[model samples]
Target: MKQTVQLAGLSCQNCVKHTTAAFSKLEGVESVTIDLDQQLAQVTTDTAYQVQDYQEVLGPLPYKVESVL
Candidate 1:
């Protein structure tokens, strides 16, 4: 499955990579694409995961998940 999530506090392209890597480490996640310019993240995964899982993956970074669709 694929999910598009609204993101906040993504200030640079490097941040995109950081976020992508975090999500990529998850068991179910196959891929992660974060567009800093668009303030969005496209995540592809096969297993069910919760939003809190993402928050934990991101650590204490100043980011907010505005939505998931």
Candidate 2:
């Protein structure tokens, strides 16, 4: 499964690193890539992951998930 999570408040590579780390820790997550130009995180997973599941992992960050596309 693949998802593009639109994020707000991200302005640097550290944000990408943080987002990648968080999502990578989720169960069945295979990969995470952030596109700073689009303010989106492209995630690849092995399980049926839901939108809220992504939010849950990112909840503690300063960045906010705008949507899942």
TM-score of each: 0.85, 0.87
In candidate 2, how many Å is residue 61 off?
1.1
Clashing pairs in 2: none
Top-scoring candidate (lDDT): 2
The C-alpha local distance difference test score for the whole of candidate 1 amounts to 0.82
Model 2 lDDT tens row, 4-55: 8888888999988998999899988898999987898888887766677877
Which ranges in model 2 have alpha carbons more than 4 Å from their true place? none
| Candidate 1 lDDT score at position 24 | 90
Per-model CA lDDT versus the true structure: 0.82, 0.85
Decoy 1 TM-score against native: 0.85
Encode model 1's per-residue lDDT on 1-69: one tens digit a residue.
998878889998778878888879888888888888899989999976667777788887778777777
Global lDDT of model 2: 0.85
